[model samples]
Target chain A: EAGVTQFPSHSVIEKGQTVTLRCDPISGHDNLYWYRRVMGKEIKFLLHFVKESKQDESGMPNNRFLAERTGGTYSTLKVQPAELEDSGVYFCASSQVRIVSTEAFFGQGTRLTVV
Target chain B: TQLLEQSPQFLSIQEGENLTVYCNSSSVFSSLQWYRQEPGEGPVLLVTVVTGGEVKKLKRLTFQFGDARKDSSLHITAAQTGDTGLYLCAGALTGSARQLTFGSGTQLTVLP
Candidate 1:
């Protein structure tokens, strides 16, 4: 079985441009999550999806950030009109457990650079 | 502000040395987890401590949860170069959200 996979491991976009990050979770996993790590900061939670339904999205920064999980297998996070502060490493994770605090497998992460 | 506070944000030690990293918080969590991440890669779960005052050991790494479930610690014995990476601590509060609040992370560099 393959671990969680993220596409375009590295992305460089100009400020005000739009960038979409994708994540393909492990097969048979029901819980998928998105996180981001800014320079010199802790990795922060973005959102979570339980199948195709968004379980929680309180971590979303603003309306410019949109995350969708179509069919509950893959997830995409789109940053519209990206800003300089939006440059960071975006991570995707998945877990087999339906409950909280379980072991989660993470992807290599998409390093987004907005200059 | 970060819900979890990890001390010694960076540490450099020689191989065969022992070190202990700590994670603290004012808010009690239902469970806590420790993860390690190398360059260009995502974090990998090291261990999870659920019960307060519980202690679990994996190989040379020992994890301990606080008596009140508000803190945890990770101790590495005879550290190896392979252990060099970023160590992160996360806590999960009880509720349906199930989101894990992460710490700032400790970057450990073990030199041979």
Candidate 2:
């Protein structure tokens, strides 16, 4: 099966611009997650989706960032009025099951640079 | 607050040498997972340790979980150049919403 796939491996935009990153999870996967790393920081969780419903979004940074999974399939993360601090690598991952034993497959990640 | 902290942010060693990396936390977790990520790619799961005091070995790599489920370690014996990458430790907390908290990561360089 194909691994998690993300589009626009790298993105460069001016500050205050809006950017949307897309992720296509593995077929039949029920769990989807978004994470990001800025500078030397750890990979921080952003949000999770179980099908089209959001499972948890406590990790979301602020109101400028939004994520959605439609039709219980692919997901998208949009950053409106992006700021300089929002420039980082955004990773999308998915797992076959929700349990601990299932390994999450991550995409190559979209490197966003807000200039 | 960061739930997990890894020591020795970076390490550079010659090939065939042995090295050990640590992951520690004050909060208890249901499980901990280790991942290796190379440049331009996302992290790949190396191993997962669930039970406290559990020790699992994958070839020359050994993983150990603390007796309190608050810490873990990864020991790479006879490290090779191929083992060079960023090592990350993530903790899965207990409860219905299982989100993973990751450490800052250790970047290892194995010189040939």
Candidate with the greatest DockQ versus the true structure:
1
Clash counts for all predictions: 0, 0
Candidate 2 lDDT, B4-106, residue by residue in tens: 9898799999999999999999988889999999999988889988899999999999999999999999999999999999999988876645568899999
Interface quality of candidate 2 as DockQ? 0.66
For candidate 2, the lDDT comes to 0.91
lDDT of 2 by residue, A1-115 (tens): 7899998899999999999999999999888999999997899999989999999999899999999999999999999999999999999989866557336778999999999
* Clashing residue pairs, backbone N/CA/C < 3 A, model 1: none
DockQ of each: 0.73, 0.66
Provide the lDDT at A40 for model 2.
78
Interface RMSD of the predictions, in order shown? 1.6, 1.7
